[model samples]
Target: MIIELKSLDEIDPCEFAYYANDPNINTYLRNSFPAPYTLDHALSFITHSLQHHALDFAIVVDGKCVGCVGVTFQKDIFLKNAEIGYWLNSQYWGKGIMSQVIKMLCSYLFSNYTIHKICADVFAENKASCIVLEKNGFIQEGYRREHIYKDGCYHDLILYALWRNSDEY
Candidate 1:
């Protein structure tokens, strides 16, 4: 599957609403990405991205928006840090697309911005996501036990990072 990145405008809001509403896909992501995702939610997301100039891109695969990937450049003392976040449509899980997406996005971020490292947090039970980060040369940084309270329960969060100037990465 040839995957490409584009702005959210290329995606049909209805299709995006349909895909983003999947509980399976939203499971590991932040609670802000509500399930039962609606067109209003999609519009809100698009509006926020446009308004804030967020570095977010829609993952287009086989001509459909399968996911979104983005990085948040921190502020103040954390200004040199960029945090990455992503979620794929459940149907595309085992195809190795997101790993490539992460790699491409990481390279783009490092080249375009002044940053010390890019980091991501993965829910402990999400071993697949952890593997993806590891495969992309992101080293495990810390383990926050019962760090996330989502879906009515607490979950451990694993911190993983990749340095911009590291030779090993």
Candidate 2:
């Protein structure tokens, strides 16, 4: 399968809405990603993407927005680091798409920015994500026990990071 990461403007709002609304997909992500994701939310996201000059991208598969990925660069003393985020359609699960997407994004971020680290904090229950990050050369830096409270309970957060000058990067 061919997967291309494109800027937000290059993606269709309708297609974006179609993919962003998945409950399973939203389960592991932050609460900001609404469960009943609507056209309005997609439009709002598009607007933010346009205005923020965000590192975000729409994961395009054959011209359709099947997933999304991005990074948030830190400020001040942490300017050399960024946090990575991503999600794929449930229908595309177990297809090895996200690993490649993560690799591609990491490569771009390391190449284009002066970032020294790219990281992600995955819910401890998410075994697949932890494995994927490990496969991509992200080391387990720390574990925050019960670092988050969501979906009506507490959840641990696993911190994973990749260094810019490392062989992995």
Candidate 3:
């Protein structure tokens, strides 16, 4: 599978909106992404992504987008770190595709950007995500209780990180 960084215009916003709108897909995501997501929301998100200095890409497989992954750089004391975010279509779950994409992105970021640490947050109930992080050598840093209120209840968030100079597992 080949991974490439793409601009918003390079992707189909409608397809992305449909994937995000799926209830099962948004269940573990942050509150900023509303359920029943629409094309307008996706358009807005694309606009924001383009404006920001973040590295965002549509995860393409066999020339079709199955998901997206991005690195959002934080300011101030977190300047040397980037928060990674990603999502895949439910149909592609358990296929190890995301693991490959994430590993590729992490390597690319370390080489191309000034980021020293890559961080990610997984919902406490999402064991699959936790496994993925572990498989990629991301160490569990901490857990924040009731950090995010999603799907009508507060959810704990597990923080994980991988350093650029760490040994590859």
Best by lDDT: 2
The residue ranges of model 3 lying beyond 4 angstroms of the native Cα positions read 1-5
lDDT of 3: 0.83
Compared with the true structure, all predictions reach lDDT values of: 0.89, 0.89, 0.83
lDDT of 2 by residue, 35-154 (tens): 899999999988987898888899998778999998899999999999999998898878888988999999988888889999899999998889889889999999999999998999
CA displacement after TM-score superposition, residue 159 of candidate 2 (Å)? 0.5
How well does each candidate superpose onto the true structure, as a TM-score? Answer: 0.95, 0.97, 0.90
- Range of the 10 consecutive residues with the lowest summed lDDT in candidate 2: 20-29
What ranking of all candidate models by lDDT puts the best one first?
A: 2, 1, 3
The top-ranked prediction according to TM-score is 2
Better of 2 and 3 by TM-score: 2
Q: What are the C-alpha RMSDs, in order, of all predicted structures?
A: 1.2, 0.9, 1.8
Itemize residue pairs with steric clashes in candidate 1. none
Tens digits of per-residue lDDT for model 1, 1-169: 7799998777887777777888788788887888888889999998899789999999989889878898899999999999999988898899999889998898888888889899999999998899999989999999999999987999999999999877643
